[model samples]
Target: MVSEEADSWGLGEGGSRSWPTSKPERVDDQVTVLNEHRRLSLQEIDNARFSWIHAKICFVAGAGFFADAYDIFAISIIVSMLGYVYGNEDGNLSPWQSTGLKVATPIGNLIGQLVFGSLADIFGRKRVYGAELVLMVTATFGQALAGHGRAVNIVDVLVLWRFVMGIGCGGDYPQSAILMSEFAPIRTRGRLMTAVFSCQGWGQLVAGLVGLITVSAYKGAIRDASYPAIYPVDCIWRIIVGFGCIPGLIAFYFRYTIPETPRFTMDIQRNIAQATRDINNILSARRHTVAKGLSSDTLVMAPRASLADFIKHFSEWNNLKVLVGTAYSWFALDIPFYSLTLNSSAILTYSNFGKIDGNSPNDVYESLFRICSGNLVLTVAGFLPGFWVSFCLIDSWGRKTIQFMGFIVLTVLFMIMGFAYVPLNSTGPGQHAFIFLYCLANFFQNFGPNTTTFIVPGEAFPTRYRSTAYGISAACGKIGAVVAQFALGHTLLNSNKDMQIVLEVLSFVMFTGILSTQLIPETNQKALEYLSNESQEAYITGAIERGVPLYA
Candidate 1:
């Protein structure tokens, strides 16, 4: 049956065809056969039953996100401690210094997304997966060691090291998302992707908890009559930042040990034997069945991807439009997401959870506790629950609908908070009300765009370009993060009506995201091939030639 199907599409005997020395003279016939074989091979993955391999993939992939979030968010706690230790008598960071500290990692993230994303496409995902973790582990230790010397300023050292660490965090975004997406079955793809991404919430939650515990543990030391106030607080930040390395180290060996994705083997390398062997090995251990019909003898190789090929492939309007939509929507979503998230300490201060006026050691400890406690509250109440909600509903609700709903709700919440900032900030009860709305906003973000944006780009593109497209989309989001940290954050801090204006602007940004969401097609429960125009065209052509109905 397989041979007959191959022969009908003009594939040579045993489905092993010679590589043409030049561009195919008959593009349609060649493309149809290749896509058909790819469709069948990938479908096996899509239809496969739930197994331990899927769970293993999710854990290995999710560890990266957990580390990324922990590293990124630990700074929020560290920043507050920095103000206590290094701030001028006023106990505040210089606006310029704060901006640099906040924006540095995002700049590195942008570069990493572009560089590592393309590298994964060219060198293969397995080859590139764990390299980032090594950078992360090294840079994390470097961040802890910062400020140990009197000659170098702590903030400068931290900014430099965190920027390097950010590159590793950035690389994980595409590497994990594409890796899990390629391995997941279609029925659970959204849930599996969300499972990996949901670790981000825990990372944030753990960051807050760690900050709370670390500072509390040193509370007695801060109150000691002999030690300087700066001494105990300085150690707090280092411990929090250094703790990020644990998850990365735990995940590194597993990530490195995993085989290259089966899709990459079949679709890019065109090595059916290796792809089949890998798939069957996974199945034998986890599914009690093995892949059948793939020849173990042939080693067919697809043309290597190049800069020109990338341009030619994406030059088509259909391909370009999806890329633009994913990129722009992610960019739109991250503007407010990162701006608010990265600066949650300031928001908590504004909400009156911590003391803004304190120079004494006892006062510093009290302030640190309050801030860390507030962050923990927000994480537990808002961030973690939001992620789990999305994890539960993303597959059922569909990515587009959930994203649209999230953006719209976020728009309304931001507008309310923006327009009502003065009244809300004025009274204790009003502030509590404000925090509730803020938590709801966080919930919608996770249940909405945050989870969907990551999942969609991972699944929407063809396997050959999946990581590259995810990288571009993620890179654009980081650009938004950079703009938020540097541009909007700076403006909000400088402006007289800081909270009001920031919230209003973020509301407007969310509204624009709704418009961008329209460009992306619904992807829930669909085959990856159906999402790619090139593959879909070939699949349909081959189906018709074989007298199979279009639906089949």
Candidate 2:
């Protein structure tokens, strides 16, 4: 019998020591070894202080996300620039072309999330991490160089590349979240992971700055040209997008070198000895066996990951609910998020919050500058602050409470903006108030479900399924994003009435997210194993009575 206190993961106590006899017996030895193993693995992770390795991991993981955000959101501005250079008489892309550009990446993300997520679990995080970044970098640069061959229009070429980029972006979600969550101490896990996700704000901010800079750099040429300012405008979009790959390229080497998480090694690979040494390296000065008095390494026949095991584990409502909760919550949140976020330029103009006049060369400069300025204001005043505030309070206020509060507040804000659209935008003062509410909505989106959706799935599952489940959850969110991009293309860009309808619909969507939030457990300051709701005592069954050890 395993001891009740064998591991702090809620296993029951009381056991008798039985080493490998001529006939091997029960798991007192297995409990001791497994417990010590966890002390070195899970406990060390839960209790370890923040270190430089953690900082390095944060940058390596966050850099890819930064690139992801820059790529995705920059499209709104990119579309505007593309229209200026490539549009018909009015200097705007047709609705079909615009929708194609917006929708391709999320579709790609859906595929990447499912595929890369499982690949990471089946193969390994370290093996799968950098590949996505490479794909993203290649696709991003490819878009810049893409041309309008008669066989394939430049818009189609860009869309295809964007889809490829989306896959890479999708892969980063699970990889970064799983890696950051698994490696962090339970105490600081929420904050650290938020720190990585918060990079999205910085990415968005940088995209805006890049847009503003590129357009301004071509001001002289544009001022003297025709309405579309074809050559200068063409240069502007390419420069902004091509620059996205720089952040990813800078971090590629470090991502390639990042250590595989200990949980994956111990739980998935079933390698106790090597897992122990990994912890030892992380804690070189404080190295000592927590197993008290055990000598010689013994092979532990831990639970293995198999298809049957996966079905059996998630088949249970307890585990399935967490998955359901995470997926649906993310799905509901993204409906409004992706709709308004990616089409900010359109929404801003419709709300009269952003100023844009015509297709004239002078108008082009002003339009680009104002759109970037609007995005920057939203990022700095709303998105950035919301992320850091969540970082500070996520552990203390608890994930569930913050999620509930965020959804509720956003619901109210969206209704106010949606239902009162005419009155809110009727005057300069009214429009200013509308923009303030817009900023508030962005703030709560980050401080609330956005951060938690990314954080919870990574923490709530067992090691074997963590990345895969997170990917499923993230994919569900992208589905909503795909829907939103379609909405952004077809409806939200049209008129105030359409914007009003979408915002009203999104308020209800935010409310639905609150209900879904009920499905997930509060994962504050709990060991990942404890949150997994699995029995741990017999996790490592008995010493190697037969086959050779995986790591001796």
Candidate 3:
């Protein structure tokens, strides 16, 4: 080897020509080079064979997130339909009740995330993924058909079904993120996970578009009658909420074809040979016709993991460290995220859409404009820039730094909005500017902590407990959502002062979030399967310590 590179190393002519074959250091260096070359060769072979297959898997896995977004937003859009439907005849329900339809799902989501998330942790992603799709599809379609009967009050049924669907939608967050993260190549894990999550923007956009069209469909009825006829309202709502079922159907088909994560099949299942053969088949298929045979069902033989064993490896000190970090970070992150999102409808009502009046010149137009414009702005301006930032700088800027910066900025904006709300009490430029600033704050929130909190749990955990760790962390996030749903949306929106108080509280939450972020280690260069037992224990215990239990 030295002779071949003699010219480059200047080993020819007067230079020493003999390689240090007798030296242990030189022997070690040679072995290192050979091992590196062999590893690279295997990786190259795998890439050559399986790139397209992995891409297909990513696309399929990503669909779950898309559906989750659509389903979640679809429930929100159904609010307008309900307000039009139920408010017409008896006028018994308040505007709050109409909005409650939107609120009910997140309430359900809190339960679903805890329950289904636990199941995913116990059963594995593939089984839960399929089960969630089935449940969501069934419940969603049930919501659609519930109004078909003449005597049935659609409003009650809508709320009932949404809560059930929420459970399924809620389950998707952890399962989809964990599943994609587990299967992704170490080098591309961040991008792959983000890609799956980024479908959320698409889902929100779909919801807004559906809202736009549905609102327009009922505009005449809404304007002509005290409340639109219940029949038209019910029909429009059924169509809108039913949109959620599409992604579930697509996810079901995709999961049937896709194999479970090789890591999960190997590490958790302990089916090393089957895992190896699966990887080989993926690799072999890259270059030639690999047999399409499924491996023996030996992957399922790994004894079901228990909650006791789940926490079995945790040492108290390290466990507490992780528990505090994950739980605080999630809580901090959700305070701003959920607070803003839950109040989005209220924000639009009072924003540039021309004040919160039942009667105004451009009220309908303004409402439509706010929904579409905000969605477009967030989808294009907020989410795209966030994705770009994460893509370009996540490795370089680091997660903790970016997250802290985002929280600080959000806190400042919330403070401004709170002050602005105190004095600028009317519909004017002050309110307008503050709303724009608030929107800008929300945009940044999505770009930063909103995305990072989800990312951290998956990356911070070891393979053995990755699902459990994320499930518990994600359940914390929903607790934040539940708080936001009940507190910010319903409780705070009763008056402008309430909004100010809510924003003030959120400022404190964000500050705490920034502080908690200090505890988490940077995961930029870490491999998914390589987290330490101590770190894993720290993550779980830390989460439990800080997290208010979902059940409690």
Best by lDDT: 2
List TM-score per model, in order. 0.89, 0.93, 0.78
Q: Give the alpha carbon lDDT tens digit for every residue of 448-536 in model 3.
A: 78777777777666555777777677777767776776767675557656777888888788888888887776655445433433321
Q: Which residue pairs collide in model 3, if any?
A: 49-286, 318-538, 319-537, 322-538, 322-539, 322-542, 323-541, 323-542, 323-543, 324-542
- Choose 2 or 3, whichever is better by lDDT: 2
Better of 1 and 2 by TM-score: 2
What would the per-residue lDDT of candidate 2 be over residues 462-504, giving only the tens digit for each residue?
Answer: 8999899999999999999988878644687666688888889
Best by TM-score: 2
Q: Candidate 1 at residue 108, lDDT? A: 84
Q: What is the C-alpha lDDT of each candidate?
A: 0.80, 0.83, 0.61
After superposition, which runs of candidate 1 have C-alpha atoms over 4 Å from their true positions?
Answer: 1-37, 148-150, 225-228, 284-304, 494-496, 536-552
Given candidate 1, what's the lDDT at residue 512? 95
Clash totals for all candidate models? 0, 6, 10
